[model samples]
Target: MKVVIAGGHGKIAMLLHPILEEKGHTVKGLIRKEEQADDLRKAGAEPVVVDLEKEDDISEYVGEADAVVFAAGAGPGSGKERKWSVDRDGATKLMEAAKKNDIERYVMISAMGLETPRGDDVFQVYQQAKLQADKALRNSGLNYVIIKPGRLTNDEGTGKVKIAEKLDRGEIPREDVARVIAEILEDDTIEDVEFDLLSGDDEIKVALQEFV
Candidate 1:
């Protein structure tokens, strides 16, 4: 399998690259900066320079991939406009590229509790943007999975997670989220599934069994 990850320099994406490579999958990472290419290469992923916000057409880069993963974000330091551009518009554009290339499998690294209001003004707008992106994916007619994880921490992964259509608010390590993404990619049985993910006692593969 060939997997292309947007925002390949991201914490979760970097961690995920090795897992897919170890499983015999070719990994391509989309990065905006040329300097970030070396980091992705060290992690065993081929790097492609493509700025999601500026690129009008990305099918040339994403075409022929088995799947595409949207791991891009505008970051907390960025303003509200960038939130809509990178998070919302970036995701939609990837969907369009996927359709143009006839790639159906997609995994979205979305945030949890999009329906609830908890953050400040800017964060609220971020939530709204994610909500809109998720809506588009549901209507996109693509085989997709939306993994909405709670507050992300930098702690080491426990290799356990609680997954459900709706899960209470909680936190999970970035490593765990990367592991889950790799798991979902390998299992074709998981399709059109949207879930809230959090740290839990259940094993990753076993916890996912119920969803399948």
Candidate 2:
């Protein structure tokens, strides 16, 4: 399968690239900066430089991929405006590109607890943007999976996870999240599912099997 990921230079995307490649899937990452191209190449993905914020049409960038992943974000340091552009509008464009390119599978890296309100100022805007984007994908009539994880950590992954339609608020490592995405991409059986995730005693594949 061929996969295209938005925010290809992101922490999770970097971790995910080699995993997908090892599984024999071709990967392409869409990045905003020319410098980030080398980093993506090192991670075993073809890097395409395209600023999601400036570009209106992205079908050419997504070209001939089996799946698309929206891992892009407007980072915590970014102001509220970028939350709308990168988090919301950026994701919207990816969906459009996927449809135009006839890509059926989409996996969204969304935030947990978006239905409830939290945070002050910019954080709130971020939540709203993600929620809107998730809604758009659900309505897009595409085979989609929305992985909404709790507080993310940089700790080592245990290769275990607890996944459900809605899991209690908890934390999981970024490595584990990347592994989960790789597994989801390889298995076409998992479709139109949205779940919250956290570290747990169950094996990742087994836990996902229960929900997907």
Candidate 3:
């Protein structure tokens, strides 16, 4: 499959690139800077410079891929104000691009507990931004899998993941989340279920397959 990854150089993308490539999938990394293109290339993915925060004609790039992944983010360097720009507006831009390109299968890495509209916690600001993005995707009339994880860590991949259809709790490793993203890309069995993952003793594949 030809996969277009927005934010392909992110922590999640670090693990995703190898998993997808190992499965023989072609990847396109949508980056914001021309310099980031080199890193994407080294990861075995073709890079395209696109600022997902801005509105533009994405028909060209989105139309070229079979699937799209919104892995792009504003990053920690981007101040708190960027929460809206990158997480909400940026994500919306990418999805709009996908819609224009006629790409239906989209996998998004979202945040946990953004379903509500009220929260003032500083960290929860990210959730506010993600909430807007998630709402847009839900109303986009497209097939999307929104993976919302608790806290992220640099722990090694345990190959075990816990998944619940309406996961009301838990945290997971970014690596395992990356692995799940790969699985969602390949499997058509996963319908329109929102997933919240966490690191546990259960087998990763099995836990994920449960949702299928």
Candidate 4:
């Protein structure tokens, strides 16, 4: 399988590259900065430089890939406008690209507990943007899996997780999230479903069994 990740240089995406490579899949990461290419290369992924916020049509960048992952985001410090551009619009553009390129599998790295918008104005907008993007993917009529993970941490991955249609607010390591994404990409049985993820007792494969 060939996989394209929109935020190639992101923390979770960087972790995911090597895992996908080890699974015998080709990986390409879409990066906004040219300098990020080396980092992606070291992680075993080819880097394609394309600014998601600026590109109206990114289908060419997406090219021929078996799957595309929407992992790009406006940083937490950015304003509400960027939230719409990078988070909502960027993700939607990827969905369009996937459809244009005939890519049936799209995996979205969304957030959990977005149904109730909270936080400051900017944060609320961010949540709203994510919610909109998730809705778009769900209605896009593609084989999609939206993994809504809780607060992300940098802790080491334990390879155990809890997945369900709705999970209590919690947190999980970025590494574990990447592991789950990798597993989902390989498991064709998991499609058109969204789930909340957190660190728990079940192994990665076992936790995903219910979705299969």
The models' CA-based lDDT, in order, is 0.93, 0.94, 0.78, 0.95
Clashing pairs in 4: none
Give the C-alpha miss distance for residue 175 in model 1, angstroms.
0.7
All-Cα superposition RMSD per candidate: 0.8, 0.7, 2.2, 0.7
Cα lDDT of candidate 2 equals 0.94
lDDT of 1 by residue, 54-125 (tens): 988888977688899999999898889988999999999999999999998999999899999777888988
* Two-way TM-score contest, 3 vs 4, winner: 4
| Candidate 1 ranges with C-alpha deviation above 4 Å | none
So what's the TM-score on candidate 2? 0.98
Clashes of 4: 0
Error of 2 at 28 (Å): 0.3
Encode model 2's per-residue lDDT on 1-212: one tens digit a residue. 99999999998999999999998999999999999999999999999999999999989988999999999999989999999999999999999999998999999999889989888979999999999999999999889999999999999899999998887889999999999999999889999999999998888889989886
Task: State model 3's lDDT.
Answer: 0.78
Query: Which number leads on lDDT?
Result: 4
Candidate 3: list runs displaced more than 4 Å: 116-122, 166-170
Poorly placed runs, candidate 4 (over 4 Å): none
Give the Å shift of residue 33 in candidate 1: 0.4
- lDDT accuracy of residue 90 in candidate 1: 91
TM-score of each: 0.98, 0.98, 0.90, 0.99
Whichever of 1 and 4 has more lDDT, that candidate is: 4
